[model samples]
Target chain A: MRLFHGQRAWVLQRLTALVVLLLLALTAATLLIGPAPSYERWHALATSAPGAVLIVIFFAALCGHAWVGVRDIVLDYIQPTALRLPLLALIAFILIAITLRVTLTMATHFTVGA
Target chain B: MPAPPRAAPKFLNLAQIRFPIGAIASIGHRISGVLLLISLPFLVLALERSLRSEADYAALGTWLNSPWRALLLVVMVWAATHHLLAGVRHMLMDIGIGSRLAQARMSAWSTIVAALLIALLAAMRWLS
Candidate 1:
């Protein structure tokens, strides 16, 4: 059975990948080039509205990219439909949960910090 | 004259194959992708803790500074760097920039070398 076939998944993977790459580089650069690492700075960056929103976007992209990547791998190595379907479903659940948790965490913090 | 029949190889032997540099980079991409996926929950846990409170942030920092986690971080840094570089290489190839064999091999080698160097830098920065 084709789990995540077609051009749409392929395009999703690449697009999400670019988003993740750019955001990660931005975050890394800010951490490295700015003042010494500290809890205050990190908290501020994470809780700021724009920062929090960007972070949420970053994680969303990450989950999307991961789902596609993992689905491809599972489809490739796992032969049995019984095993593969369950495995893909598990991964999908995990990614969705991660996305929700991150969004909630950022939302809570942003609201409190504002 | 009819050719003599020969039996086909029954099993594929992975050990006998020498992977090309590009193939090595390609596999590294998949491996690193999976590793990053496995580590995501823990990473998000850290992010949550770090944002929860100053005390929690400090606690998480201390935990990360420990020897074992430091090692794991090094591995993660390498994985992230390699995955990023190889992914960019793939994207460029998709756009027809590095589709040639020589250029592809060069990019693959560069990706691996650059990722290692960046990871080494992170290790020094963190472990020192």
Candidate 2:
């Protein structure tokens, strides 16, 4: 799927946005009714299988949504191809790196706890 | 050869150009999205740190509670709340709700106000 171009990017942005919004609402609900915040509780939740997986999904959707959103801004404002292309590349690289790092962190914690 | 059409005169003064309410909300969406995008790394770092260990989690909390970091957190909260509320408006408009000029303006104003209120609440929560 041409994930980053034309109509696909637009669709992807909306879909990821929906995903992020739902996840955020779920998080807020949990925090509101669940036990008060503490390090042990936070750590335990992060290491739980369902929590870890959902967190991973949340970050994935968030980063993807951000990619399209930022791309739109860069395209609108940065007219020079030379500057814009490199800036876009840099943004993409940083986002990809962040996604990987979150995944890795979650994976390590999950495995270590298991 | 036919003469080429002349370009329209451009009004390039940003300060002089008055943005409508909808336009202000629309630009706020873009600006907040950029702010959130730039803040992603810090979010990830917080996640990583909080999950590392009990001590690390406490350290991260303490770090965030510092005056400057707390201020930055408030800014991030504003960015997030504004982006999320404005995004919901966009989605609603996509589904043909509030697409009329009057409704759109009203929704835009509500989104901006709600976002600020939420941000203010967040700040109060943090401070308390």
Model 1 clashing residue pairs (backbone):
none
Clashing pairs in 2: none
Q: Taking the tens digit of each residue's C-alpha lDDT, what string does model 2 give over B1-128?
A: 87657975777998899889999999999989989988889889889888877898778767767777787788888889899999999999999999999999999999999888888987887766
For every candidate, give the share of true A-B contacts it also has.
1.00, 0.94
Q: What tens digits encode model 1's per-residue C-alpha lDDT throughout A1-114?
A: 854569999999999999998888898898878665788788888788888998899989999999999988987899999999988999999999999999998888885444
Weakest lDDT window of 10 consecutive positions for candidate 2 chain A: A31-40
- CA lDDT, candidate 1, residue A39: 81
Residue B86's lDDT within candidate 2 is 93
CAPRI-style quality class for the chain A–B interface of candidate 1: high
